[model samples]
Structure formats: structure tokens, C-alpha cells
Target: MTNNLLNENYWTTRYLNKSTAWDTGEVTFPIKQYLDQLDNKEINILIPGAGNGYEVIYAFEKGFKIIHILDISFLPLKQFEEACPDFPKAQIHHQNFFEHIGQYDLILEQTFFCSLPPILRSDYVKKMIELLKPNGKLVGVLFGIDFQKEGPPFGGQMKEYRKLFSKEFEIVKLEPCINSIPPRMGTELFFSLRKIQ
Candidate 1:
């Protein structure tokens, strides 16, 4: 946690004050499309930094039962509980992403990576590898442009992301996102990486 501003209290306060502009209020298009094409319903899944658990709701509704949602801020988790009362309570985790320990068959990356200070990007990659089962996939979208201001929505280019992730995972898909939400349209990269055996 080198970035003091990214700690739990900071995020909790943002949620408390309704400052979460990163939230789209729905599962973004790229992740939803990726999940729709997956055939397996039994694999264990983890979504780290799962803000409102929108994707968790989508996955659960689509018949994926073994899903987990983790967040540093309990505020959103509490709201998520209210939104999906039927989702198993045990599957909702309030914890730091780096401190979480579990093996997952799939790890979905949403806005989590960019929310951290850019210095923690390598730690994020290493932790993703540690959390995944052998051959497990890490899939989702990343911002493809460098932001003009300091960012919880920090952004980076494709070449930098590819170089960073390739150290631990086999780069499977790292390209411009064709299905991003309108505001994010040309600025997002859809990616899938497999943990190296």
C-alpha cells in the first residue's frame, strides 16, 4: 500500500460521499460479453476490488454460482447485499485485495487495477498470479490512455500493460476494447491473460 490515498478509508469516504464516478451503475459491456461466451458454470471465480458487485450480480444471474466479490470498502458490499439478497453472504468479502488468500479458476478485473497508484501495478499483477488456479484466466478491461490528472482512474498504454503482465501470465488477449461503454469507448483495452504453469 505505497499509495496512502488508496487505502480503505479513502475509498470508503468516496462511497460515503457519493464520489464514485468510476461506477457505471451496471456491468460494463466488455466483461458482460466475455462472461456470456463462457460455457462453464462450476468454476470458482473472484472479482477483486468489486465495487458495487454489478458483475457479480450478472454472473450469478447467468448461472455462475461459485462467485466471490471482494472490496476494501464495506459500504458497497453492504449495498450489494441489499441489491442481491439471494447471493450467498459468505461469498461477499470485505478485505484488502493484497491480503485476500484463495485459489480461483477465474479472476475478473474490472476497475480495480487503475484505481491503485500506478506504483502498485506490479504488485497487482503478482497478486493476481498468486490468487489464480493453474491455467486460470484473468480477464477484463484496462484504460488505454494516460490521464491528464492524478487518478483513481489512472490509465496506461497497451505496450506498457502487455510488458507488465507478460512477466507472470501468458498474454492471451490485450487489445483495444470494441464494446466499452460510450464514455470509455476508445480508451479501454479488453484483455485476457492465463497464469503461466
Candidate 2:
């Protein structure tokens, strides 16, 4: 189902038809706040499922020299390229997240996790562990409420996330996001998990 439902064609079609309700057009509050507090400009960072990646642009503008953005669909990556002409083309990875192999000091998640099939959640955790350097982090927001609709914007609760992630990570912060966008307010959880040895 994942190979069919959440594949490149599915997302590429979403981008072509302007069906991206998840595209916030700018950086959302929780992630922006996290980025604002980062003191290191040289940290290796990766943003996967980074559709029209506003966070990538934001990090680059802040002088982060090692920012990589990946999208299975080439559509959003193309859009990002046109939008940020100075960003190095080599840094944009047009590939599947599961097939991506690299180490990062930090991996920023926005809408990527929930977009995957819930059955692949375990794979997501394992792959995250593979991608992070020792003590590196996976930080971002996740849906805190169950959605009434069938979705790529799938919903999940904190309890499930805790159970799934705690086995492999040091759960630093997994709580209600106090600074989500107005439409998503009270429905999101901000999380920061450190990879365990």
C-alpha cells in the first residue's frame, strides 16, 4: 500500500494540482523557533519529504553551510530550486527517504512522518537511527489528534508516538506544541529525540 499510496506519483500529482494544504508558504512557528535558537551554523542538517522546503531556505539564509533537502517527487525540488537559485543543486536530493543514506547532525521533521503509511512507522524509527550521527537529533512537530478523514495528513496521538519511539531514542521533549500555526493550534506535538547508541 505504501508503494502505491504514498509513492512519488501520488505526491507529484499533489504538487502539480496545487493540492498541498500542508504547504504553509513559510516556516511554521515551532520549527522556526527551534531554528532560531541553534547556535551552530555548520551543523549537517537534512529535511526529508521537504516539499517546497521553506525550512531549507531559512537555514541557508541563517548561514548553515550543510543543509540537504530530499523529496521523492522531483516537483517540489524543482520549485525549491527556482525559488532559491543560489542554493547548491547538489544538496537537493531527489530520492526516496528509505533509500537515502547519509549522516546528519540534525534532521528536521515537519509534515513528513504522518505522510507515511502507519505500518512503516517502525521503519521510520530505524531509518532515523541510521541517518543520525551519534547523539544527533530528530526534531519537529507531529499530529497530536486523530483525524476524522482518511489522509496523507494522517493523525496520531502522543501515547502511540511515545511507545514507538522510546525504545530507540532518548525522548527529550514530546509534548503539546505551544506555538503551532493557528489552524493547527492544539492539534500538534513538538518532539525532540536523541539517537541512542
Q: Give the TM-scores of the predictions, in the order they appear.
A: 0.97, 0.98
Cα distance off (Å), candidate 2, residue 12 = 0.7
Model 2, position 88, has a per-residue lDDT of 91
| CA lDDT of every candidate | 0.92, 0.94
Number of the top candidate by lDDT? 2
Please name the candidate that would achieve the greatest TM-score relative to the true structure. Answer: 2
lDDT of 2: 0.94
**Where does candidate 2 stray beyond 4 Å?**
none
Q: Give the TM-score of candidate 2.
A: 0.98
lDDT of 2 by residue, 1-197 (tens): 67765589988998889999999999899988999999999999999999999999999998987999999999999989999999998899999999999999999999999898898999999999999999999999999999998887888999999999999999999999999999999999999999998
RMSD of 1: 1.1
In the range 1-197, model 1's lDDT, one tens digit per residue, is 45555588989999999999989999989889999999999999999899899999999999999999999998999999999999998899999999999999999999999898888889898899899999999999999999998887889999999899989999989999999999989999999999999
Worst 10 residues of 1 by lDDT: 1-10
